[model samples]
Target: MSTAVATRSGARRIRLDVRLLVLALVMAGAVGYLMYTGLQGTAASYFVTVSELQARASEVDGRRVRVGGDVVTGSIVRGGPGEPIHFRIGDGTSELEVVYSGVLPDIFAEGRHVIVEGLYRNGQPVQADSVLTQCPSRFEAAPTASSS
Candidate 1:
């Protein structure tokens, strides 16, 4: 009788340990899944200059990127609403052609710095899905002292 009771207790302990391990694994999986989804939803992109983008064009071909540069003068060709807007952005040393089709911001214009987000293919213009213009830090001019 003593041997039978000892065997039964040991079996129960083993079953309980197995159940606890399975529960822990399930909880870990749930936490991992939540983290992955949370990060994917709020992923942020960093800016790359036109020169940097061109230098690495081969490696980043067809990949999504955000390119920042000043819009080249006389390079903005605005189309009617809902049409494609063509422009070139240059980072002093290099230029990247861009094409965007959407409602442009009110402040968007030639000569303003812009950040374009889209797919880039080597030897081709960037097909931009979004264009964001950089606003100037000084909205008002500094007050000057009048000569006495």
Candidate 2:
């Protein structure tokens, strides 16, 4: 009968609409999850000073962190080919040893401002995954007072 056929057709449409709605919600959730994870991956790690990092050694050990300090002069030791580079980074009053196994930046050197991102191990040394350096001349020279 025409009435019976129309009833079945309406039910089918309703079922299809429900399925589509569920699918849309699932897709949206997947996209949201991907975006959240992607942003997390690209987020910058929290920057910590050498002294702060030292003070929080127990809380931060084995966790990823970013530390900024000047490279300690006379502390860089280059190993044989393919070996890790060892150095010390310090604030004026606190310092930590860093061991890196990657290629050093061209401007990396002693007494330079550097940021190392990695994990702190054994409550002392940082096992650096990346090393960044700031150009010494990037800032303008201080203005001098003219003699009267």
Candidates in order have lDDT scores of: 0.92, 0.92
**lDDT of candidate 2 over 1-148, digit per residue (tens):** 9999999999999999999999999999999999999888777655789999989888887898899999999999999999999999999999899999999999999999999999887566899999999887757899899999
As for model 1, its CA RMSD to the true structure in angstroms is 3.7
Best by TM-score: 2
Clashes of each: 0, 0
lDDT of 1: 0.92
lDDT of 1 by residue, 67-141 (tens): 999999999998987789999999899999999997778888888999999999999999999999988767778
Off by over 4 Å in 2: 62-64, 134-148
